[model samples]
Target chain A: MARTLINLPKTAKAGAVIEIKTLISHPMETGYRPGPEGRLVPRDIITEFVCRFEGEEVFRAELFPATSANPYLTFTTLAERSGTFTFTWTGDNGFSQTESAALTVT
Target chain B: MRRALLGLLLLAVPAAAEIAPGERRSGFDQMTPELRAMQTDEAANPGQLWVGDGEEAWAAAPPTGRPACAGCHGAVATMRGVAARYPAWDEAAARPVDLQGRINLCRTRHQGADPLPFESRPLLALTAAVAAQSRGLPVAPPADPRLDPARAEGERLFTRRTGQLDLACAQCHDALWGRRLGASTIPQGHPNGYPLYRLEWQDLGSLQRRLRNCLTGMRAEPYPFGAPEYLALELHLMRRAQGLAIEAPAVRP
Candidate 1:
């Protein structure tokens, strides 16, 4: 399983825009690069990333081959209530990982 | 008579000025603001991914069915400050072994597993994790008589010119540090931040890999990985960086 890191404030004021950051380890190999014996390396990349709060989608991104290895994303979302934020990353080679964090709204 | 005296004074000057202890700077201080931010933020630092893997490996049993690291050593947190004094003398091997070597020794002697290949993900991951425990601690090379000869050899290697460039490491790192080389600023080549993530490589690498990169850049044949020369150089570097805080799993551009 690929390792991932998620960062967000444990508590935030209601209606505040809380920032969230994430990073995951993946080679994100581009198809154009040549491997041993001059053959092209096959493309493999995280196809999509989704962040949801309390089962409601908050943000989503569509990744491409050009994306760098170990994809990192940072975005802000309004904190309305206390709940868990779930993150899902789906990629080539049937790679998928899910993680969650709790945020309390004051 | 005045001209002769001036010539004598000029000849007396050393070839290169050694960097004073207080004047030394870690590669972290030389990084750009953006890169510095990347290094400080755990969520943004890609090196943490390896640390995570390392945490798992530290506890998981290998195919040998032997006890895991935690089974003997307990939680990895107890390993704090251990990495700072690496490349230490190994009584069994009758030589100096760096932190990576020590880990591999444990694998072979205690865990009954084959040594992990150099620069492999598993090795880098475990090394990074162990070194991360020493973060913020000062680099304090052990005060052992046996290490002196190796450290001297390392110093000699650092000063001796080599490769097609015929330039010693001191030329750029000690004397010309703070000067621009191409688009990059030449920072004092310190070893505090190691097993770090470099933007150029897009992956974490060991100090040996980096040293080999420099050797290749100089058009010289690099010693094989885990070579004695590389280990000696690492020993000298750790001593040179004494009192500097450890920044393992650091980020660089």
Candidate 2:
């Protein structure tokens, strides 16, 4: 899995709408079958992913098998008095990631 | 005034090559007969092994809780042209739906089959078998007023850019298609051949899957499977390559 890339507005009004972008590099295999040797590849997938502002969850998602590998999401959020925004990914592999960026509200 | 008008026209003119600018393609000139042959071989053989496995799964698993698709369709060859005609204008749904969506509907409503994941091999093989039926025929979507919205949506989605790279579909396929993107070349990335076998992927992939791949390549937040915007793009791409040959299970270098 490749590291995710996130792009958020460097600066925004204290209370303005901004689009947040996130992309992760994951093969996202929906382990429904075996790839080689007929052994089940095992069902491992990213089941939950979320974004938070200062420890407060802002956006959350429950992924299914239909979701593509390397999931990408675009969303809007109110820039409520900038602070540290954290993004996290939780997958079936028990693999999780947490990355954060500073947002300055002016 | 005429001279100035001509100048403006010249300024407006595009000097791009066959593909959109900033994109890379080996170009028709560089396409080797050998490479084309390899791809042709894959297409010719088709993924019979996988489809055969799917047929067995369909028979044993009983997704529909009815009988196997083999029992109803007998042989998939009889169901040819079904895929090419869908996201068909379903009278019941009143919309265009792709094979996966249709399969889901059938599994839930008709057969009680399980809805496989988007990239699942079973789903891929089943859809491939169905689409394979239309292997030789040109994709001809029905003409209806309802398709207007989808067409426009597709066009818009095709051109809109939303990513750190900030490049739209046109930027690559239309603007800098023939240009270099690092080491590899970019093809026009036409949708004529999908559920294609890409050397990079080493397996069959759908049109929707390709669109998601492009979004990732562009570093944009990609939409979900069966997303309206992406579906529109697929519809538009299929429409764009209307007369092109359907090259499924094709191998790309």
Candidate 3:
């Protein structure tokens, strides 16, 4: 299930400022419920998120226990470089998700 | 300003008893024997946290020097038949008393302890134990005319219009019977087995709790805890499910 929404600006100037936002829907449960085997479910959550442009890391975040269920993020970026920006979420239980969008600098 | 204030007021009511999230799952008619067995096991085990507390309440004598129903009633079996006949006409009081009221009476008059809050753990457990005693007994409303008024009140609540959803309680549970609202299916809304541990909630909740869910599902402002409206509805639904087995801790989507 793709939890995030990615919206790219239609176009951008070479040095123009650009904004991007993302939101994901998840319970992000605290693993408080005992599993079928009576063992507490491991704390599998999105602990890391990274956004990169043209192979350069533009933004990074380290999530903690307090991060609420539906996480949302917005940030400003420069259109000085034109290429694809990739977003990824990494966590326990091999949970991984990736999304990408392209920008053209003129 | 008037419109905005009205909207805010409307929002406040729904906010109090809002369903945590998502739609109430439907399709509850499909239950296998394995699922039924699982339900039995869950019910047999003491309810999470609450049951243990109730056991303590029952065994410990209060300082007020009131008689202990426990010393006489002993276990649920002794009082099971009593519940199935409740909200009945008490010729003495000449008015109806729901289970919560009755529990309060015992605590205040006989148990020597203060009455627990309507939706609190102690109250729920006491009600649970008392209601459990009537496990196999059929719901039998008192034949006296006194109950007619309360039952009429409940029926009115079930059909009343409310909320942004523009729904009445029966519009779905009664009119749309056997329909799917989302991932889960809906069954005939019955209260035979309450204090149920619904799978969707992943916790044991009272029928009133479920009513809160319904009010939220329909986007209506829910009545406050221990509200008269909810008690009336409870009485009505319990009577409706009269012939059905009391299946507390029952699983629902």
- lDDT: which candidate is best? 1
Q: Model 3, stretches more than 4 Å misplaced?
A: A1-106, B1-29, B32-34, B42-56, B89-94
Candidates ranked, most accurate by lDDT first? 1, 2, 3
- In angstroms, the error of model 3 at A99 is 49
Give the interface RMSD of each candidate: 0.7, 13.9, 16.8
Kindly state the number of residue pairs that clash in model 3: 8
Better of 2 and 3 by lDDT: 2
TM-score of 1: 0.93
- Say what the interface RMSD of candidate 2 is: 13.9
lDDT value, residue B137 of candidate 2: 73
How big a share of the true inter-chain contacts is recovered in candidate 1? 0.92
True lDDT of residue B10, candidate 2: 82
| Residue range B1-253, candidate 3, lDDT tens digits | 9999999999777433322223222222355555555455532222423444455566666677765657756855576666666655545556677776777877776676887776776677667666666665665666667677788799788878888988888777766666677855566687765566565664556777889999998899888877778767877766655555565435554
* DockQ (model 2, Cα): 0.01
Clashing pairs in 1: none
TM-score of each: 0.93, 0.59, 0.59
User: On a 0 to 1 TM-score scale, where does candidate 2 land against the true structure?
Assistant: 0.59
* Candidate 3 residue A95 C-alpha distance from true site, Å: 29
Clashing pairs in 3: B25-B184, B26-B184, B26-B185, B26-B186, B27-B185, B27-B186, B80-B133, B80-B134
- Cα lDDT for residue B73, candidate 1: 94
lDDT string, candidate 1, B69-166, tens digits: 99899999988988899989999999999988999999999999999999999999999999999999999999999999999999888888999999
